[model samples]
Target: MWQQKKANRRMSGGAMNSGKWKEDELIQQMLRIAVPIALQFFMLACVSATDAVMLGFVDQTALSSVSLAGQIQFVLNLFVSGIAIGCGIMIAQYWGKNDPKSIEQLMPVALYANVLFGGVFTLLALLLPEQLMRIFAKDAALISGGAAYLRAVALSYLFCGISQVYLTLLKNTERVLLSSKISSVAVVLNILLNAILIFGFLGFPAMGITGAAIATVFARAVELIWAYLAVKQERTGI
Candidate 1:
């Protein structure tokens, strides 16, 4: 009986060890999933910081223009993020159920919703930029400069609509690292283009705040294209 009890204790110890190993593995997997998502958002925040810092070198008015103009994007992001989060929850559920076809069907719905929201904001920004700027600032320079920024960046709203949905899908589908890479590459390009186009480096014309807006537009466009390519490669199609 004592021998049998000793063997049982040994088995219990082994079980504990196995459980501990699994716990460690679970933690590692969670980190693998979380770190890239965190990094993507970090890089995204850096874009705005880069713009503020770089434009500050030009003048206070330029600095203020980009800063205030960014508010429009910020508000739109709230709506986009809400949609993306809802879609992520649904996709994760579908993935858990092993329902790929349902996910495929859902993708187009989310994409259209995002694009629709983005289009509305694009039109508003394009057609009523000065009025939109006035909602944030009363100064004439701010209204005029930020209006230019808004109009130039209006197209990016549509592009981001597409990219952000894909990115959220990527996260849900366990491809968060790729999502991070796409955002990071686009951010780097944006920062580089901001410097080049703002000051006309490498023979590029100095476009001031307009250059900053264009940089964002170009970066969002690249991000959308990259996400689309990733979707194609991964077969995450609608």
Candidate 2:
């Protein structure tokens, strides 16, 4: 009986190892999963560069406004990203346990929590954008423009929160490639829309500070749609 149990254990281990034996295949899979993610993050970072370039071309005020607004958004993002990391930990542990239902159950609570926290944060940004700007000791043009820009893009926390949570869910589910694709699509949409809206190209209204807000909202929407589609396709199923 002892020998039989040992043989069973060895066979089980061999079966597991056999399925994972193709080192090249594993490497390819890792690259497929990792490259897109790296690219997506790079793309997101590029958006900031793009924003600075385009706004600077418009005028110094446009550049300053967007830059200041970005500062407030950045601080809020730190908190939201922290929450996302915690959610990731929860999702990863549950996923390892093969509990999709738990993931589904936990996601809404996490999302709603982000929403609640983000909403309050947005309120503070809206109500006291100028005060926050003054704290930065920016020049007059930047302080006023930044205040205006923050007011215009005040919903940033909500938009970012929604996008961040969904992406985190995908990551924990091991759908990193798909998540990256979604992010890439959103970045493209954002850049295109920014050009059109900011420049009034094709007769679109040149919204200026408001244009940046619109682009952000549109990009988040695209990201959310792609994430939902991925979830519907069961790509994240273990």
Candidate 3:
């Protein structure tokens, strides 16, 4: 009876160990997805930083003002970006369960919500640039330059929102590398344009700080175009 009991216990222990191993494997798989997403997020932040630096070179006041206005979007973007990833996670799980239709259905809802929010925020930012700038700075020079920068970049909110949803969807669908590549290209374009426009290099007129906002809008346009193309391809595959 003692020997039999010992054998039974050993069997139970082995089963428990196997269950733990399977959990570990699942975690590893999730990490495989999470790691790349984290890295891509970091690279995108770097792109924003580069834009800020390029703008600073054009005019410090403009940079400061834009930075303040940007903070409004940044705070709001936290929610928008969060909703995007949350939707993606749901879609991804559904896809894993072989429910591709759920992905199609969910993507549009997220996209439209962001677009609407973006439109509202863009209007507010553009219309009240000076008021927004005052929240961050008391200096007249800084306020003037910053207001100009904010007004210009505020137009990009709509484009940025639409592109963000699509990009997030692609990431959720396991198209991480492609999304990263597209963002990489946009960052390069932004940096190059900043150099040319900010300093009036390559026959471009120096538009001062306002030029940096234009460069950013141009970069965002490139990003949106790429995202649209990718969405088309994704739809075809689906």
Candidate 4:
């Protein structure tokens, strides 16, 4: 009976060891996915933080104007995010079944939808910026400032919409680290350029609120470029 007891103890120990190993592996996998995604969100938040901080130094009016203008961007992101989330869900399901062809079919549809939405917003901002600003604020100074920002940032909508789709696809395909890195780099560059342009650092003219809008546009362009290159390299295996 003592020998049988000893055998059972050994069997239980082996089972526990196997279970622990699996738990460790699961934790590692979760961290691998979670950390990059968390970083990506942090970087995106930093873009707005950078804008608010730098614009604050310019003046209260500039700060308030940009903040109000940013609301439009916030609403646009909500729409884009909804589309991206839908794409991610479909892609995840298809990927589980090893259906790359289906993924290919779904992506262009999402892209078209995103671009269409982006174009509509861009036109509204570019052509009727004051009207849009009036929806958010009544002060004439705020409207004037926000209209300038909207015009400067209008082109970014198109670039940002396209890039967002690509980044979502990258994340779904397990290129989370690459997506995070691209966004981080672009945000950092934007902060740097914001300082340089907004304050006339390095002898650049102090472009003020216009400079802030330009920085965002430039950063979105950088993200789109880097995402394109990364996707191209992945496809070519180079």
Q: What TM-scores do the predictions have?
A: 0.98, 0.82, 0.82, 0.93
Q: Which runs of model 2 end up more than 4 angstroms from their true locations?
A: 1-26, 232-238
Q: Score residue 58 of candidate 2 by CA lDDT.
A: 82
Write model 4 residue lDDT over 1-238, tens digit each, in one string: 9999999999999999999999999999889878998988898888788889989999999999999999999999998999989998888788778887888888889889999989999999999999999999999999999999999999888888888888887888878888888888988998898998999999899999999888889999999988878877776111
Identify the superior model by lDDT, candidate 2 or candidate 4.
4
Q: What is the lDDT of residue 182 in candidate 3?
A: 76
For each candidate, C-alpha RMSD in Å?
Answer: 0.9, 5.5, 3.4, 2.1
Q: Rate the local accuracy (lDDT) of all candidates.
A: 0.92, 0.81, 0.79, 0.89
**How big is the positional error of residue 184 in model 2, measured in Å on the Cα after superposition?**
1.2
lDDT of 1 by residue, 1-238 (tens): 9999999999999999999999999999999988988888898889888898889888999999889988999999998999999999999999889898999999999999999999999999999999999999999989999999999999999999889999888889888888889999999999999999888999999998999999999999999999998988999766
Question: For residues 82-114, what per-residue lDDT tens digits would candidate 2 score against the true structure?
Answer: 888998999999999998888888888778888
Task: Put down candidate 3 lDDT per residue, 113-206, tens digits, no spaces.
Answer: 8888888878877898888878878898878887888788886788888888878777777887777777778778877887787789999898
Which prediction has the highest TM-score against the true structure? 1
**Native-to-model Cα distance after best TM-score fit, residue 117 in candidate 4, in Å:** 1.1
- Root mean square deviation (Cα) for candidate 4: 2.1
Candidate 4 similarity to native, TM-score: 0.93
